[model samples]
Target: MIVLLLGILVLAIGGCVCVVWADRGGPRWVRAVAAVTLAAGELLRIARRNRRRSIKRSSGGDE
Candidate 1:
């Protein structure tokens, strides 16, 4: 389990690096990895936002 978590952490760091490099005109593969990373980040952000909205509605918070 620890190894898996470490691997994920490393990958996330690498993805972030690729994103920066791609922005500065890195190779095609780097750009591809950056695109995937950005998409995944956006999806996760949207999912978390939706989850928060649902939780608020359930608890009777103002819409």
Candidate 2:
């Protein structure tokens, strides 16, 4: 689990780097990686938010 988390963190960082690189006209590949990374991050964020919402709902909607 720890390894998996670390891998995700690495990917997130790589994605951020790619975004910056692409913005500075790095290359087509960098832009592609940036797109994928940003999309994955967005998906993960949505999933996490939904999970938290479900947990809150299950626990009588308490804060």
Best by TM-score: 1
List residue ranges in candidate 2 displaced over 4 A.
1-9
> Residue-wise lDDT of candidate 2 within 1-63, one digit each (tens)?
999999989987888999999889988999999888888889999999999999999999968
Cα TM-score of candidate 1: 0.93
In order of appearance, the predictions have TM-scores of 0.93, 0.77
Candidate 1's displacement at residue 40, Å, is 0.5
Candidate that scores best on lDDT? 1
Give candidate 2's total backbone clashes: 0
What is the alpha-carbon RMSD of candidate 1 to the true structure?
1.3
Candidate 1 Cα errors over 4 Å, as ranges:
none
Q: Report the Cα lDDT for candidate 1.
A: 0.98
